[model samples]
Target: MNSDAPRPSPRAIASLLVLSCIVGLNTVDRNMLGLLLPQIQQEIHISDMMLGVLMGPAFMIVYSVCSLPIAWLADRTSRRGIIVCGLTFWSLVTAATGFAQNLVQLLAARIGLGMGEASNMAPASALIGDTFGGRYRVLAMAVFAAGGPVAIMICYPIIGRITAEQGWRAAYAFMGLAGLGVATLTLLIVRESRVDPAHGKAGTPVATQAASGIWRATRQVAGTPGFALLCLASVMVSVNFGAMLAWLPSFMVRLRGLDTATTGALLGTYKGLVGVAGSIAGGLIVTGLMRFDQRWLAWAPMLFCLGIIPAELMLLFADAPSWWHIGLAADTLLMSAITPCLFALLLSLLDSGLRATGVALYLLIFNLVGQSIGPLAVGMINDQLSAAWGTAALRSSLLIAPLSAAAGAALLLALAARLDTSQAAPG
Candidate 1:
């Protein structure tokens, strides 16, 4: 992927906005399952472990596994085409989720959704890097990345209402149909463009690396400085994110005695609205820090991870409204730093030609191990302790998320230390 057009052009800005919207749609479609878990549970009668299985392995297994090949294809082919096809396919799968009659059908639908979404982030993230280089790239990526929280802010309340009034199935159908429109818009608006190969940061040598077989590309990506440590950090941080997002509504409903509407409103304000703020702030903070030292890319996220550990713990255990609000706001803001920082560090580090593959591998480990383990661990804890302590069992179970977040912070510190002595892995 290469580009010659001025990065600040109106057309480029519009394209980025459109692409970001598409990414947000992807988030809403994927996480809608977690959002409506209570409604789904009422209809399907799933155990906590089974819920974990559905949220964790059943979806993420295919999501993480299939992304590698899709990313390889994206690296070599047309990214916009792949994104269009994927969004369309996943939207259909999301709608298909409404037709699920039992847990088996739901599982099948979720797997299909995963397979479709596997094609999403890598290509898009890589495309953004291609479009906007250097400091601007991080900010652009931050905007794109905010699609997650923005989607929640924009869609969660509506979806919650739909679930409360029309049922979870209706919410599923609504989101799926909405995604089809978004896909069509993306197909119309976003164009595939390439610039001189010389424009790439790593240039001709790296281009050859992408053309080589997958194994060599894998090694090249894996060998990039701080790449392994970044992956480790992502894996750890995603554990907390995965559990928190997946269980948030459940947690609110079961422990705080909130209904779906109330929970959605609360989350939309805190996790979604505050989260959107955090994303932009992360980009701005890192971009400014990079003026002094690129190592700040690693350092900033380490600090965020440390901040999130205690905030998440407070979110889980604090009984006072003030502490809960402070914790939730702080966690959303601090945790928001991780994705942009990680992706910015990753895209900056990798040669342009193989970005999708590198990102895919990073996501594979992050999701397959970290995200899977978090929700599963929490659900297992819930099942084991629910009888003894009831809904409060989840409060205890959620403690693991912060500890895992701490582990992520430790890895980021290691990455920063490595960057201290090395000249690589930076803007």
Candidate 2:
């Protein structure tokens, strides 16, 4: 089978596993800070805004900024080497996070970690796109993307325990060591496939080619209607994602009266098992739906919107029943389910060479607009409302949940119509 064609083969599975590990490791490592934030706050005397910024903008700026260049390199260079190097860099930095003496130092370490983390996604996404084409690619994406949940399940508990007993520093050190091991394995096992001819001959300097390629890929995707809508949907999705991931555990503990251990465990459970199931389900659904009609891209966000209804209710009024446990658990499961479908649609819209840069552009906009603002915005709202509503303020601020979901669904619908209109237009 040609590299560009759709096929099911051993190469596809191998590529899927590698991308899965990349996604899984990045998600787990990034979230480790969330689990340890309270400890870091106590030790560092930082404000909530500062904490939010560190998790949001401070890391994201570097992560988002570097992604395009790294992705550009991935398109023209050895993706395996890029991924392995990225894994090693971030893992080492994650471990180095143990050594911070002040807020500035910790923030700096996170920036380095962000840069390293940025390297993995674009390249890995592109690799999977190349390995598995057409309908099968969606399932491969689902499987690979399922790594995020899998890592959450496996890593959260370990980080929680380490932070609880050994101190946050120990947790950092341990995460770093684990990352190092994974990095070594990646270097040894991930084989590089032949580069596409359009990427130019392999021996050409990657840096020179990457500069031209980045501009070209950006032009292609920017001009493509499907890509633009996906990017828009990504921003809305990030707003929902950033706010929840950053604040949800705190919300659960404060509102439901759960201890950190319980909150962490619950989060792990919902995000781990339910998230994995949702990703796989979304992939399968999209794969099946695309077989009959490609317009499911427009229909996809509606499912996301529907999921938000239960989620918002759980976040807001669900406190009344004293069944906050069930509400929180259910909310988490629903929250985790919608994203894989969104991503599957976006990935399918582009070809292999352009996918990474497209993903990078998506992440760049996603982090700058949504990830950068969403958490801080919610936190500020919580602060203002907290004085009046006290703990209940979190419930109010979480209104973003349903609202963002609805908006996203609308955007997706518009996008589908645009896509159809574009296809009908004469060349």
- After superposition, the stretches of candidate 1 with alpha carbons farther than 4 Å from their true spots are 1-6, 194-196, 199-206, 420-427
The residue-level lDDT of candidate 1 at 236 comes to: 90
What are the per-residue Cα lDDT tens digits for candidate 1 across 1-427? 1122345556666778888888888778877777788888888899999899898889899999999899988887889899999999999999989999899999999899899999898888877867776567888888988888888898999998998899999988998998899888887788754332533435455455554777778888898877888888889998998898888889999988899988887888776788889999999998887777788888898899899988988888899979988999999998876788888888878777878888899889999998899889899999999999998999999888889888988998888888752354333
Model 1: lDDT of residue 290: 79
Clashing pairs in 2: none
lDDT of 2 by residue, 148-246 (tens): 988888777777777778888998898788888887777666665533443334565443343465787788767755777777776787787787788
Error of 1 at 6 (Å): 5.0
Best candidate (score: lDDT): 1
What local lDDT score does residue 232 receive in model 2, on the 0 to 100 scale?
Answer: 78
- Give each model's whole-structure lDDT: 0.83, 0.73
RMSD of 1: 2.6
